[model samples]
Target: MGVVKDWRDKELSISEVIRKYPHISPFVIIKTDVQRRGVNYTEKALAKVDPDIHQVEYRGMFREKGDATPVSLILRDGTSILTAFSVEEGKREPILVDVIDDRIVLVDQGEILEEVEYWEKPDYYDKFTSSGKPMWQIAAARPQRIDINPNQYCQFWETPGHGCKYCSIAATYNSSKENKPKILNVDDIAETVEEALKEPGRYESIFLTGGSILNGKELLDEEVDLYIEILKRIGKNFGGKRFPSQLIGTAFNEEQLRRIYDTTGLTSYTADIEVLDKDLFEWVCPGKSARIGYDEWKRRLYKAVEIFGVGNVTTGLVVGVEMATPKGFQSEDESLEKCLAEAEELAKHGVSTVGCVWNVAPGSVFFNQMSPSLEYYIRFADGLDQIRRKYNLNVDMDNYRRCGNHPDTDLSRI
Candidate 1:
């Protein structure tokens, strides 16, 4: 949720915000807005989804059970907009994914904002693992990456007031009618990635992220051990000692972090510090705070930088989440100021910050909240980009070609 409003309860329209920030790419702005205020598919738009051609069904992270709805949208310039439709009610007028002149486009109130296309399905999507598990369920494909979620269920949700307020992983898992594995089998993953790599030039990196496994030998040792095992199996595909891979898991201490870096071919690491500020982090991500305090979390990120090296170690921010009600900052101005300052501090230590647009997930505590204005998001994006420039840190691991969910990282293409 990010935008600077010209008046109370009213923010500048996406077009108005674009005109205001002439330097920022309109496609990124549209993607950011679509992320904040979700998207609704027109019948004509949904008709374009061919199960055999386009990537349609997905393993949803939010509250909607996945089916064919064009998993997400992609702009003509290769920017991926990872938006989703929610089953539960939330407040916001989602833009329309409609067909215009026989082409897929994003429309707002009868006006075409930008032409888009559905993500193409990887060849391995329809295939099956050696164990007879669907390959799609083992490794989900992004436009330029293969994602493997080892653990479907997070331990953080077991205790009340310990879960992240903005996350819907628990709600999504508990509400689903289908019987699924809590932790995916290693053989299924290795076989899935093995088949997926056969698709030439389709993937640039392999990403692994899952719910925080708090019960380990030490804090997050179980989570770290799981990634190393899956990675070593995936490493058999390549000859090099280091592969183009990233693991976004719990913030492991130096010892656990070393086990992953020294044992696997993974070249990059990310432990998402969801919110920027320590106080906001505690309120929004109580579980993380309980497991690894905010100060210690930052220290662990600095430790990751030491292990993974610069440009390879990064942290993720759920941008605009600092404005949550009751405990969050009240003004967009204050939230932006607070987040960018913290991001800059991390950058000084050679840690690059990548942000994802924060939308009110259906099952989240903030389901009824409204996001910040579009202007606020654009400004915040530009600020993040500028901070990287100032620190001379690069976001190569999470850029447009690797992970395009962050609107700020998409600007790096320019």
Candidate 2:
């Protein structure tokens, strides 16, 4: 195990640790720490934001980086850290991104760690639709992809105890004006995609994801149909050709998967298993287990690869959640072993795996729970990366540039 750097107390700097793990990008390590602890802006940092050019007060459910604040920061290398705006009680001392001496840099106790740059606003961000809806609201642009959320509220949250333990989707949804509109208008989505595509060479892929839609002819028929409609609409922009896209939704059956593929230009599919271990998944994601069952969920993922094709479909796992207390794996070593084994099983069937570090948010059931150590995460990322390589599966859909949230996928670049 590597020595834990006392970066918060300034006892040991992250820069020192970066030298130790030369295999992992220095930017990634910093991004992980910033995300794990969260960030706080100094007055100087906030002052650097430009409302007109940057995305500030656009109508959305979540807060913008800042009016003049850059949407997100990029390190010396092109690693993106798209953090949410959150200020909660007892939070750790977040790294401060400040404009010190006319240069935007990450500072801790006035120690300049690295020069950083804000994520540039996309070309279409300033454009508006003929109907006057700001294109940014219609679709949120990432470095290499466009994000579309069809529904904001997960019905599981409707009941007192059915929601997942580590989710703030409903809380975040309630706060957004765009999501407050409830369901996404299919016409609006089609129109927005049409306009967004006008900026040539801007976007490499389009992705659609949303909260669980439990209503339909079958369990997720309604959810499946909603995507089918939107996909068909967006397909117009691709001239009926399948574009690079992924749908991170609830696990759908073979029938539902086929229907979606036959109807739209979607090329990749993802159904986040969330937690790798079965018992932890049951307790942490009660709604998912009760509705789809753990075995069925994995089955659907493998089945999706059959429909979407291997290298084109994958399942996401919340990397640290397997260690959640009470029913979770007792040891970090055990958790990593189990998660990698399961991932390999899925990979053998042509279903790739991606992992995102669990962010223990205030609204989650595991809010008070602590995540695993950084060393544990690094090992887990390394292990999962090996599994993908062993299976020879492709993860271009959620790789570093496309998604940027998955540490395991991030390691794929190595």
Leading candidate by TM-score = 1
**TM-score of candidate 1 to 2 decimals:** 0.94
Candidate 2: regions farther than 4 A off: 1-19, 57-69, 85-91, 175-179
Q: What RMSD value applies to candidate 1? A: 3.2
lDDT of 1 by residue, 135-193 (tens): 98888888788999999999999989888988889887998777888899999998999
* Per-residue lDDT of candidate 2, residues 105-142 (tens digit): 88766788788877667777777777677777778777
Screening candidate 2 with a backbone cut-off below 3 angstroms (N, C-alpha, C), the clashing residue pairs are 49-68, 49-69, 50-68, 61-176, 165-365, 216-222
Q: Tell me, what's the RMSD of every candidate? A: 3.2, 3.7
* lDDT (C-alpha, whole model) for all candidates: 0.84, 0.78
Indicate the TM-score of model 2. 0.91
